[model samples]
Target: MFCYQCEQTTRGTACTTQGACGKTPDTAALQDLLVHAAQGISQYAHRLGKMGIRRNAADAFTLDALFTTVTNVNFDPDRLEGLLRNAAALRDTLRADYAQACAAAGQAPEALSGPATWEPAPDLAGLVAQGQAVGIDTRIAALGADLAGLQELVVYGLKGAAAYACHARLLGREDESVYAFVQEALTALAEDEPSVDALLSLSLRTGAMSVTVLALLDGANTGAYGHPVPTPVLMGHVRGKAILVSGHDLKDLEELLKQTEGTGINVYTHGEMLPAHGYPELKKYAHLVGHYGGAWQRQRSEFDAFPGAILMTTNCIQQPAPGYADRIFTSGLVAWPGVTHIADHDYAPVIQAALAADGFTDESPVRHHLAGFHHDAVLGVADKVIEAVKGGAIRHFTLIGGCDGAEGARSYYTDMAVALPQDTVVLTLGCGKFRVIDQDLGTVAGLPRLLDMGQCNDSYSAVKVALALSEAFGVGVNDLPLSLVISWYEQKAVAVLLALLHLGVKNIRLGPKLPAFVTPAVLKVLVEHYNIMPIGTVEDDLKAMGLAA
Candidate 1:
């Protein structure tokens, strides 16, 4: 199995033996098979859509299947095998529909090849063989790394969009155009021959689609939970039975909070869920206690000592350690071989687990962190911010946001945040904020020096803020005294980066290292077109951003 779809891919290359995220060879093979199967489904689904037919089931499956293949989301072979079988079944059904539509239109059904014509074998062994037959290397050999990388880039961005769309769908938000683009792009990836130029164009289209989906998700979240406001969250242990909710699903977190209310159990946010505390609807729950740890990469140690039940609502789930495996529960497409999964939005089992385990006996001293500086909150203070900028009290604005990983180079973000001058305002999102979240950057013009926008998808908030600032100053976004220093680890970050590029945002610095899947030619294209650069030392990047460190 060869996988290099993430930042921590072995030696900044391929993970050939075992995934750096703890995915085994068997699981990696299954994920590849699942992606291939989704592509096949897309082939027929795309054709069906052109025939004036829409199948919401196929569209939903396509999103979930791709999301499941995201790194560290699912390690359960049994679950993957089920998804593969379901994908094949969906493909066959859609193919029949396409044929029926063609025949009804008095035209001969075109004979399709590639994934469209291929058949899956009966068992796991046969499926693995089929996966090996159409692996990444085969595609690279046929199309060259440049084109292959472009195709994979498009697919990964689609996956990220699908993940965000899935969350939005949970709250009854659906956009037909988003689903249409997802199927259309997947079918394009499975085409007989794809040119680098066409694929690059499609990659940008994927970015545009991602922007739309993220906006839809933002609406769903804010509509359901009310707009996020500035709120102080405790960072220490709380007394009594506790349950830690992680990942980026606000719906799941809300359900758990509702069920745990008045039961004498405390709910604490972890990882990406840290921003949930700022939403008025969620914050109204008194038992929804403060945040518990850093980012997703630190979960093993954090989960083990937490002394309560844990619920992982979405991706970034690592291999569970034995000490906490039984107590940890997964929901909404996250799965592990032996972990308990909660479906149907039920929380009785989770509540039972929390009661069964030993929760905190005495509370630790409370420490507070301010969050919820989303677009609305930031833009609400636009006048004050503009005044400060014009008066030279605030010299610059820097956005240090993206995914966080286990890489040592990630410390650069914390270093840069700490070294920024007092007159600078730091806006951050995603789990990467964990690096500098502990530091008190103090207030600037009556605003916290560091503003915590929601999750990675909340890059939408940052974009909105930038566009608003640009409008206020009568200049383009790039002309403002702002810089984006991003650190990425997964496909969601890919989607966000592409959206930034799509908006013509320039001089962005991306690091812990470039994606291994991005060929040199593609990298050159990005550098030339977007002026994207990799991060240097903390001091040098500060200087380059026009800061006197």
Candidate 2:
């Protein structure tokens, strides 16, 4: 039951009894079993691919299994156990196929050990018992913290990359290279006592692969939804039956909007989906209404107060409270006990639930929030931005993006955003922008000071914008007057950070705290190689970035 994969780990250490995100010991144990089983499946799949035999289904399953184990994504122990059983079955099937292929080729098949040869228990008790041998702590005890931490870093980064790959696959986008790297990385992690240097190299390779998947996701999104255009979204209530769709799955939301069209149901974006309103294709829906709430961590209170059904399309789902549990529905790898799960992209159940529930009784005052300032939109104004910079009207550019959580130190982002100099523009993405989305940072050089990129995956947009500026200014990205102050809560953010380092971006300030799984030795390596630093006080960070002193 040991888990420490998120920013909010209990007391900055492992959660041995229960996760701070409300995952039970039983669920945690089941998640560990699922990951181990997936690694076993990857072992066989990787070998099979080498033989020029591809199994897309197995690759997709590996991604789904790993994504489900992400922090706060799945808490249904029954569902996790079901996945574990499925993964074991898949591994056995692949192993036999690989053996047959080798025999037919007149080559002796290799003997498998570790998770590949181990058998799973038929029941929950046995599964928990099986997890004891495969847990990260066992590896830490045998290999020491530095090596264990490096291995976990690669594993976590792979999980995040898998999540993005899954999203792209749903949109009918598949990259065989990404799938191959995913299998290769997982199989590498399952090896017995790899050297620290090898693990570190694999970690960076995982980061490099993450950039590919993110770019794939970005293409999937913009190709399907059209390049994001700056659009003003109403932040007020609309009168009608309503359904709130949260998480980061734009495809799911698009389908729901299509199905709910002309129905009395009004669909509102919540959490990371708030930025979906900026997409031209998705925004074409008349009933797509405005955003409803703040970040994912505040959903307990926010969902209860909303007088309609809610749909969670991805991770960051907390344990549902009893009051709204029945009306909440989950899809796309998010599951909670007693919550209705809409499978196969079906939203009829969600639509019915919205119609049956009490929606907003009355309309509220109107407000607006700006989003969709994606790469194209920002780059369209590159001339003006460059002029401002050269004329000394814009002193600096800071990117305050990444995951937002319930941690108390998260308030530092809001403070930093508000305290930046009037001439500096703040670029934001991810749910982290929820902290300062409503703040009026005013306009600088005729552009709004706060520019909202897309979701966390849209870190691609930020990267693109930075590269464009660098090219325009005839300097490297790190030499530009830009600072990256990122806040990470889960593995996707880890993948994004790895991508940043892979791009040779340095001196970035990351907080509210560094990952618990990153041993001091690993942190030392990062500091020495990349000059990455932990976030200091808001004022201190501002001064350090040359924003203010």
Candidate 3:
């Protein structure tokens, strides 16, 4: 069960015995097996695609499988076992379709090996055994650290893309190219004789795909709920039976809000769902109360203290503490053993839990935090931003955002945000915005110094704004007065990083730490190609970004 696909991998190295995210050996094995099964499906699906056939089911399943393998998303062995069986079944279907398509085209069907030829065992233990056979170390042993690390890099990016795609798909939005790339890249990963250069190229392509998926998700979210606006969300809660909706699933949050409406139950966004408040449609619901808690890592204490039901919509789930474990429920791809899983997005059970619990008796004093300054919101004021830059009202623009973890070093984001000069407009995204959202950076360039741009996928928004600013100033994006200080914890941040690299964005400082899976040689290649570097102390980074403060 060697897993190092996340930033918090044990000691900044691979997790050999257990996951730092509370994933047990058995659960890790199941995730590995599920990923292996997806690879098998992709082998067949990719072939079918080349044969002028579209295996959309296999493509969809492949993304979901990879997404489930993401850190802290699904810890329930039973749920993973179910996905494994489903993957095997999906692979079989794709295999038969591939054979039929080949026969009809008068071409010989290739006999796929590796995971393609393997079979999942009859039971959970058997499946775990099968999964253990194809864990990360197996690939490292086969291809060596450099290339295998590159392949894992690609896979992690794909996982991040899949997460955004899943959220988009829930709102009935998707792109066929994103799905095709998943199959094609997974097929490449399943190859025995992998090429470093080819894998490196694939990593960039995965980044490009991440960019596409993020855009697709952005369109889906904005289309469904309307583009985010500069709305003020209550940092304080209201008096009522409350349900806290966490994770990045806007659709799930909308469903819960709809169900709990007029029932005296207030639905508060948590973690990545904080941006939901800025959506016109979602904000139209009066019962959609203010946000509760901070980032995902703080959920244990936050969820424990909240006297209401808790619903996890996606990743960012930690082990449920005994005190408030039962009050919590899982929806979408989030699952924990013994936790109530909500299928079909129904909120009856979640609502019941909220109703059964003691509501917030006394409301906290009124307080507010500004969120939602998405690409459109920011771009709508582009004239002022451009003028501010020309007039020296805004000296610089820094994009400081990414996933938030429990790491002590994560405070660097806050420090940097706080330390940035007032003339610099700070654009932020992801749950990491929790660090800077509280700071009243005041107005810069006729806008708030700190602009909250939706969730992690809204890195797209940052990219869009950068491109717009570059065009407005008649310069390249790299030449704009901008710097990206990204803090990554999980696969989604990796995907976003790839997207940045793909866009030829350079000189970015990434931290709290570098991924353990990134071999030195691979890191050297990235640094040489993209000018990427690990983040340093806030003071040094600020100086590097040309900030005197």
Candidate 4:
């Protein structure tokens, strides 16, 4: 088995024997099969579109299948097998639909090859064998490193966009164009020998689609939950039975809060859900208490120590340990082998588990973290920010955002944030904010130095704010006094990075390391095209970005 679609792959390269994220060889194999099958389905979905056959109905399934293969998401082999079967069935259905559509359009249906016409084996073992034959290593061997890497890059970006699009779909937002790009890119990947330039262009196209999806999801979230305001969330727990909700799914958190209201259970946000406290609709719930823990990487120890039920929503789930595994529950697409999964979003079990566990004996000393500086909230005070910049009260704005992982080098973000000049304002999101979540950066001209712009999914807020600032200052975003220091872990970050690239936002500093799947040849191309840079030391990067030169 081989997988390197995440930041923490083994040896900064491929993970052949097992994944660093507790993904067994078996699970990896099944994920590969699921992704391969999804590509097969997309192959037909793309062709049928030329005949004007729209299957937006099947778009959600494709998104789910691809998202399930994201790192630290669905590790359940059984679930992966089920998705693989569904993908095969969907592929056959789309194939037939495409043929019929061609006949109706008075055109001959062209025969397809590669994943388009490929068949899957019936059982899990056989499917694993099939997957091995079509996995990343096989593709790299068949297409050579550069072309294979570019294709994989495109697909990875699509996976991130599809995940965000799924979130938007859940919140009553849908865009067929985003779905079309998914199918179009997957169809490209199914090709035996696609051109490098074509793949690079398609990869950037995925970025454009990713930006659209991010905006869609952002609107869906704010539309449902109201724009986040600058709210102070208690960092300490209240005395009560608690249920810690992790991941970035706001809808699941809302549903659970509704069901557990007045049940004497406190719903605490964890990891990416930390921004839930800033959403007025979600925060209005009296039982929605506070935040617990840091990012997804610290969940094992954090969950073990917290004496209450835990709910993991969406991606960002690691393998559960026995210490807290019995009390843990999975919601949405996040799944574990032995952990209880609530695909229906039912919170009864979660509530019951919270009640069964020991409640927090008493309240701890009050501590707070500020969050909810979303685009609207930030822009509402845009005049003040612009004045501060003009008056030289604000020196630089560094966006130290994106995923947080267990690797040691990630402390670079924390250090960079702490060492930024007193006048510099820092914007943060995703689980990576845990690195500087507690830093009291104080205020510049009445604006807080540290702005928490919701979760990684809310990155649109960051980009929006950047674009607005650029407009206000009458300069391109590249000329603005802002620097993006992105920490990518999995595919979604890839999608976000692509969005930045698509916007022609250059000089991005990406770390803790480059993607292992990116060959040096592809890296050179990206570096030349986008001027993307690897993150160096805090001092050097700070000076380079005009922070402390």
Candidate 5:
């Protein structure tokens, strides 16, 4: 199974035999089949939309199907097989509708291209098709590994958006258009003879939807939990039975907090969920402990160190190590066969796992780090930030954040931090901070030069900070003295980029090598329309940013 749709892809190339993320050949093939089936459903929806079906129904179908295939989200073969069957059934329903529409229109029903046309395959065609799709196929007859890779990149970006959208949905916030466009775009990806321009347009559309999805999640988070405030979360160990919740799903965290409310299980946010502490609603839970791990890549070490149960709510999952393998509990779209997966967002098994794991025998130990840095908290310091800029205490704000990977070229970020002028402040979030964070970058006046804004999802904080700065200075964000030098590795980064574009924040510098999935035409539109440029050497990129080398 050749899969290279993530930063952790083997050897900075494709995952040709087995996945670096612990995905087996069978699982990878299933994921490919799942995507293929979803595409069939997408085609069905497109035909139905042309025949006058309300766009919302079509989108919901596509969103759930696509979200299920995101890396590390669903590894249950049984669940995936069920979804594949469901997608095929939906496609058939869509096909029947198409036939009826054609009959009513007095036209012959054209044969749609997809699984609907598949026959018995004599060999392992899934990986071959994925490879050829990414490497060779120019048209839909096959997807070359690269374009297939690019399509997967776009699809993964949409998966992150859909996850965010689902969270927002629980909070009573809805944007029908985001749903509609996601469906239409997924459908477009399956079409024959898709142009580079069209795929590029779809990437931007994905970005646009990302903007809407983020806004919806922001509203849902702030509306339900109040805007995030500057609250210090204890990274120290607590005495009692404990449960560590990872990933970025707030709703799951909320439910766990409720279930373990009166129970002895102490709650802690790991990885991306660390920022949830700033939100008033979630922070109200006194038992909500501090973060347990660093980034997703460090899970094997971190999870093993903790003695309690670890609950995974979303992506960034690694192949579990034996140290914490039995103690790990997954929820929502995250699944691992044989591991106890809590469906319907239930918390009983998670609670049971926490109990069975024999959490801390003592009351608590020492605190480690602090988190909860988010938009509202940063905005609370808006006046001071403006004053600092006006008083020349702050010269410029640089957002240097994105996903992290094992590629040695990624060290460029560390180089960037070392080279950034003392007068500039580096704003960071996500695993990218591993490149340069926790180092002495000095300060801009009295303010620390590097600000840890949180995780990849906390790119929301960077966006909020940019918007607030623009409002205070009475200038557009792009005109402000801020530069976004981002490094990406996965789909979450894709959503963040889309959000940046939706905000019209231009001239952003992105690197360590633009996604191999983006065709040349799509790159052109991004470069021309958004003025997006790839990052160069620290020396050259700094010179371009008007920073002294």
Candidate 6:
């Protein structure tokens, strides 16, 4: 298996035998095959879209298939096999329909029939050999760097889209066109005759779709649960049995809370789900407890020490420690080969796991975290925030957040936070808060300046705050007195960037070396069109933002 689609690729290169995230060679190969099949189906769908032969059902199915293949998302071999077969069947039906359509038009149809066979690229050595061959090709090699980079961008973007769509699906919302578009885009990449311009265009469209997906998820979240409000989450010891829910799926967290209600099982948010504590509907759950773990990557030790079951709903899932292996239940796309998977997003199995596992030897020994900073909640206090800003009580709004990584360079985030002026308000999202989120940035009046706005999906909350601030100040978002200094480690971040672009958000300060995967040409487009810049020293970045260094 040769996969390097994540921050945790073994040794910063390729995952030859097993993924650092616990994906075995077999599962990785199956995932690749799944992606290849989805591409095949998508290529057919693309042609159909161009020909006006719309197939909404086929399109939605194709989207789910692609989404299922994202890194650390789906690990169930049986589920992967099912999707593979579904994609093949869809491709065959579409191909047959295309042939019939051409026949009616009196044109001969090209034969590209197949049962859709995909073998794992022999081995890691074989992948290196393929890379070597590409390296040696003079004409093709000239664009090799660009090609590989663009592929990374599109792949990451697709993953992000899948995540957003999954959240939408949880809310009972469906956009068949979006699914069709995703399938069509993935299929375009499988073509032998690759078009740089074409791929670049698709990359932008991915960003555009990101905007739509974010809107859909935002609607789903806020509509189902009342807007987020500033409710103080407990960070003290709670007396009772508790279950910790992590990852980014709110639906999963909500369902677990419902199932465990009145059963003496207390629920807590960990990692990305930490933000779930912010929503009004979720906060009302008296049994919903505080955050237990720091970040997703810290699960090995944290989950091991925890006395309750850990439910991971999405990405950033690592190998389970023996201590919590049996107690961990994964729902949605997240999967680990032998782990108990709560399929169909069902909570019965999860509830069962909780009951069986000895939850909190004695009512959580201590409560040590706070969550639930959704948009509605933040907006409810918008007037006070605006007043503080105008009064010069809150001089700046710095959005310093994104995914966390293993790199030591990540320390820059913490250092950067300390360098910010006292009056500056630090707004955070995602696991990136691990940097200096615990620091006391001091409160502007009675409100803490260090406001945690939930998880990465909560980036939608950041966008909402930006737009609202702009409207309140009677200026454009970019014109508002706010700066987004973000750090990204995966595809969901890609989608969020795309959403920003769709909104014409400019001058974002991005860091940790702008994804090594972005092609020079693509980088040019981003820099020229979006004015996106990389993070220098925090002091320098802060100075540029018009704050004292």
Q: How much is 153 displaced in model 2, in angstroms? A: 0.5
Candidate 3 TM-score versus the reference = 0.98
Tell me which of candidates 1 and 6 scores higher on TM-score: 1
Q: lDDT tens string, model 2, 1-549?
A: 778888899888788888999998888888888888888898899999999988977889999998998987899978887888888888889989999999999999888777787687978889888876688888889888888888889989988998998899999988998888888888888865588789888988998999999899999999999999999988868888999999999999999999999998899999899889989999999999899989999999999988899999999898888888889999989998888888998888888889998898898888899999999899998999999999999989999989999888899999999999999899999999998898999998888999999799789999999999999999999999999999999999989999988999999999999999998888999999999899999988877777774
RMSD of model 4 against the true structure: 1.2
TM accuracy, model 1: 0.98
Residue-by-residue lDDT tens digits, candidate 3, 1-549? 899999989999889888889999999989888887888888998888877788778867888898898888999998888888788788888888888888898989998898898787988888888778888898789779997798889889989989989988989998888888998888888874688788888999998899899899889988999999989899879888999988888888888888887899988888898899999999999998799989988999999999999999899899999988989999888999999999998889989999999989998889898888999999998888888889999899898899888899988999998898889988899988988888889987567888899899788899899988888899998999999998899999989999989999999898988898889998899889998999999888887888965
lDDT tens per residue, model 4, 1-549: 888899999999889999999899888888887877877888888887766678865688889888888888898988888877777788888888988888888989888887777677878889888888888898789788888788889889988888898888889999888878788788777764588888889988989999999999999999999999989999879898999998888899989988998889988999999898999999999888888888888889999989899998888888787889899998878889888988677888888999999979889789999889999999999999999999999988999999999899999999999999999999999888998878888888888899999888998999999999999999999999999999999999999999999999999999999998788988999899888889999999888887783
TM-scores for candidates 1 onward, in order: 0.98, 0.98, 0.98, 0.98, 0.86, 0.87
Give the alpha carbon lDDT tens digit for every residue of 1-549 in model 6.
Answer: 655666556665556778766777656666666666667777677776777788865666665666676665776666666666666677778888877888887887665432133322445444333223322122234557677667757767887887888888878877766776686677666654556777767788888888778778888888887676665565533655668888888888887777788998888777777667678788888888677767777888988977767788887788777888888888876777689888776777767776777666444444334455667767888899999889988888888898887777778888878888888888888899877666767777567778888778778888888889999999998888788888877778887877787788999888675765664677898889888898888778777899864
Which sections of candidate 4 miss by over 4 Å? Answer: none
Q: Flag the better candidate by lDDT, 1 or 5.
A: 1
lDDT of 2 at 437: 92
* 3 against 6, candidate with superior lDDT: 3
How much is the lDDT of residue 366 in candidate 3?
Answer: 92
Residue 26, model 3, lDDT: 93
TM-score of 4: 0.98
Q: List candidate 6 stretches off by more than 4 Å.
A: 8-18, 49-57, 76-78, 97-143, 192-195, 362-370, 472-476, 520-525
The count of backbone overlaps in candidate 6 is 10
The TM-score of predicted model 6 comes to: 0.87
